[model samples]
Target: MRLNPLGDFIDDDTFALLQQHRLFDAKSVRDFQIRKTYREMRKKMTASDALDKLQELHPYLQYDTIRKIVYMSKAS
Candidate 1:
């Protein structure tokens, strides 16, 4: 599969850069970054703070989606 296929709902720049690489697909890259970012944010901020920061950085990101991912991961 193409790592940075056209349907991953990521920023264009990120997709373009990933498309340039040959090793990882978009899913791998996105999952890796999400975990990394979530871990770091947890170390320094409450979930509310992290959500605020993410909104500031990416206004399009829905907090609901992030909240679901966090809780679902914990449940698993």
Candidate 2:
């Protein structure tokens, strides 16, 4: 059940220091990617279809998370 075990994608020294001090949540990167994927899939398919596709791509993601991403506000 490990996520982002390699640390945040940003390798810069300042970002690394922030991560070391627990000033940020690296998991947000995964959230952002999942949200981005859902948005892209929504463009070519229905909400349910998009959810299914995202599940197929990232089976490790919880079902509720996928559902939330698919149904979240686009303006956010």
lDDT of each: 0.62, 0.72
Q: How many residue pairs clash in each candidate?
A: 2, 0
The parts of candidate 2 lying over 4 Å away from their true place are 1-23, 72-76
Model 2 lDDT tens row, 1-76: 3343333455567666786799877676566777877778778999888888888888997777888765677686
Tens-digit lDDT string for candidate 1 (1-76): 4444444477767767766785456554554455556778989999888767765654665778665544555443
TM-score, model 1 to reference: 0.50
The best candidate by lDDT is 2
TM-score, predicted candidate 2 vs. hidden true structure: 0.58
lDDT of 1: 0.62
In model 1, what are the clashing residue pairs, if there are any? 3-25, 3-26
- The stretch of ten residues in a row with the least summed lDDT in candidate 2 is 1-10
Candidate 2 yields a Cα-based lDDT of: 0.72
Candidate 1: residue 46 lDDT (0-100): 92
